[model samples]
Target: MRKFIAKTVEEMPPSGIRKFFDIASEMKDIISLSVGEPDFVTPWNVREAAIASIERGYTHYTSNHGNPALRRLIARYLRERYGTSYDWKTQTIVTVGASEALDLAFRAVIEPGDEVLVPAPSYVSYMPGVAFAGGVAVPIETKECDGFTVTAQALEAAVTPKTKAIILPYPNNPTGAVMTKEQLAAIVPVIEGSDLFVISDEIYSELTYGGRHCSIASFAEMYPRTVVINGFSKAFAMTGFRLGYAAGSEEMIAAMVKIHQYFMLCAPTASQHAGEEALRHELDTDFAQVNKMVSDYNRRRTFVYNAFKKMGLSCFEPRGAFYVFPNISGMGMTSEEFCHKLIHEKHVACVPGTAFGAAGEGFMRCSYASSMDNLKEALKRIAEFVDECRK
Candidate 1:
């Protein structure tokens, strides 16, 4: 059986984030903050749209590209919200989730032995996806002092003739770091100079704080080479619906759709209907529900940042997304050791930083997407645990 399995599939380890989550699940009274899911239910209007779709017998498969109406709305939403333009008919695709859209991007662009630059401490799926696509995943480490942004110097240094693309995981998972337009501009010279394509994951775009989210695709030079991957999961709290989309040039999207049509056929019809409604309602009401959720997340973000600061932990204040990456290096333990002790001793669960990438070795990620009461109690226990560690 071992010999029959592909070496790549057999050698891969299970997700580091999920291991602790599974452990915490079996324990009593554990407050798990490892997963990056939104706490809110899908907005009522979105869910109602899905129900109406089902009632209308729209349960069958949609076009391989997704529902035409949904694709149009996605194009409009991206253009209006992030200044990215795509032709819905030829340059967009509906995927199972941003996860699948990412996979499709890799498969479409990568040939055997091609290299894809991934910023370190990025989403866990990235390196593996590149590997499965027969590409090398070259990690470029982003520093905490720089807000975990990929600098122009770093991007320039990482590129080689073999490099085919780079994954821009802004509003980054595990770190919650976001790049401002100016920061993004600094790297544009490098990208324009190279043949490298861009895969921008903006799933957390709507949750940004202190500023609006900026897409690399908004750059005239980058727009043609960038595949912007986003979805309703993070903002609309529709993770269970498992829908996402990718927009790029017609050529790239056509190649991706070729692969996606054979593999996924299409995204869920009912979910597409729901997504259309989500975007439509957002546009019509000026993102009232989404803004409400973002406001609540901002409150939690402030509370968590202050809590960590009071504990004397060095935490980078997050500008986007709901997670905080706090340096636990001063605790004199490895990231896993710190998380293990904290969870076992305090019954509060969070992820080890090393789970993200080697650059995350001295940190740990804590999601602030939980209820305020839960966050308050968890922070209290975490404070006590930190004091005990010092002693």
Candidate 2:
């Protein structure tokens, strides 16, 4: 059996985040703050559009790059919101979700022995995806003092002859860190002369609690070199639709679409219709509903932030994303140890920081994606568990 498996596939580590989520699932009484997804249902209008498409006998494969209408909508949305523009026909490719876009982006550009610089405490998928594409993932640590953002100096230091690309995941998962315009601008000059490409995962772009989400691709120098990955999962609560898209320079998008053609054929036809609707004013209506969701998330964000502060745990104030990563080192326990003891003793489930990367070992990621009541209860249980550990 071992001999039959591909060496790379077999050597890959199982997802660290899912291990604790599986444990929590089997427990009798558990409050799960472990999953990184929206608790909100897909907006009624978006869902209805999909159903209507199917009912209208429109259930067929779209173009490999996805429906032209949806792609145009995606392109326009990015331009109007972030000031970045990509040609809908040649520079955008709809994907099965940002997951597939990320995978395709890696496969399209990475060559054997190439090194992709990934900032630490990132989404768990980036490293494995790079490895599967025969590229090495070089981790650049982002410090808490720097809001977990990789500085230009650090990025320059990580560059080597083998360095081929960089993975910039903002409103970052696990850490909830966001890179400001100035911070992103600082790195532009650093990589200006280098031949490195960038894969910017801005899936949580719409969930930022800050003024506005800025894309590294918005910079004139970075635009040509960056591939932007975004989707409807976080903002529109459309995860089940399994729809996302990638925007890059025309050449980069064409390469990714070639891979997408052979593997995925096309994204779900009905879902593409829904995606177009998601971008239209009809769905969000001045974004009042989306704003409401953000407001609620902000409330829960404050709850978790204050709860950790009250518990005397050290945590960085996250300006984006729904997660709060708190350093639990003072409890004298490894991240895994603290999480395991917490779930068993308090029946409150949160992911260990180590789940994100080795640098996350002294912390834990608690998502506020759960309901307000659930978040409050989970916080209470965590407080009690910390107190008991202290005693």
Candidate 3:
């Protein structure tokens, strides 16, 4: 018998989050905090728009770049929210989701053996997408001492001759780390003269705390070399809608569209209609609701952070997004070990930090996207587990 394997497909491991779900599925009365998805339903207006579009027979495949109305709306939304603008006709393209946008961005620029610098414990897609596109993923660990944000010093140290791009994940997934405008400014000088481009994932841009999101695209010099990937999933709780988009220099965006067309002809037709309302008319009202969700999550963050802090766990306070990435190194177990023991022993399920990347060892990511009742209950179980660990 011959072994069949391809370097690309074989190298990719199973999803870190999926493993927890699989294990939790078999357990009775499990409380899972491993989810990275939003728990909210799509807003009423957005859903109604999609339903109306479908009723009107707008079910056919749209233009490869997406419906023109949606593209225009996306461009408008970017300008309104992030102070970054793209030409709808020439610079924006909608895709299946931010996942597909990430895939397209990596495929657009990465080639065999090229090095891609990624700040660690990012959203699960970055390194894998790069690797899948035949690029090497070089993980640069961001320290909790610095709120898990990448500094210019870190970015400069990670780059080399083979480095072609950096995947900047601000309002980060697992860590909830956010870079200030000043913090982002620090890295611009490092890449000023390099041929490196930036792939900025701002999916969590709207979920940010009071401070507005700063786009790398706002930097005129960087605009030509940066591709911005964003979506309705995180911001509008439109996860199941599977609508996302990317904007960049026309040349790069066109290349991404070419690849997108050959793979996914267009995003869901009804989604494009819903996306139009989201970008143009509904965002302000919908984002108010999004902000309310963030406020609720912030309250839970305070509650959970205190729980870990009271237990003498080293937890960095997250400034944005809805996760609490507590450093569990003091617990004297690897993140995976701690997660498994907690789930099996105490019926609480949270993801190990190492699942995100090697640099994430000894940490655990907990999503506070659940109700306070569930969250408080999970923490009580965790307290009991910690007491046992200490024994």
RMSD list, candidates in order: 0.7, 1.0, 1.4
Q: Give TM per candidate.
A: 0.99, 0.98, 0.97
Lowest lDDT sum, 10 consecutive residues, model 2, at 281-290
Misplaced by over 4 Å in model 1 are none
Which digits, one per residue and each the tens of the lDDT, describe model 1 over residues 277-305? 99999999999999999999999999999
Q: Which scores greater on lDDT, model 2 or model 3? A: 2
**Lowest summed lDDT over 10 consecutive residues: which window, candidate 1?**
6-15
lDDT of each prediction vs. the true structure?
0.94, 0.91, 0.88
User: Any runs in candidate 3 off by more than 4 Å, and if so which?
Assistant: 284-286
For candidate 3, the per-residue lDDT at 302 reads: 90
> lDDT of model 1 at residue 235?
96
| Candidate number that wins on lDDT, 1 or 3 | 1
Best by TM-score: 1
* The best candidate in terms of lDDT: 1
Superposed Cα deviation of residue 117, candidate 1 (Å): 0.6
lDDT of 3 by residue, 92-148 (tens): 999999999999999999989999999998878788889989999999899999889
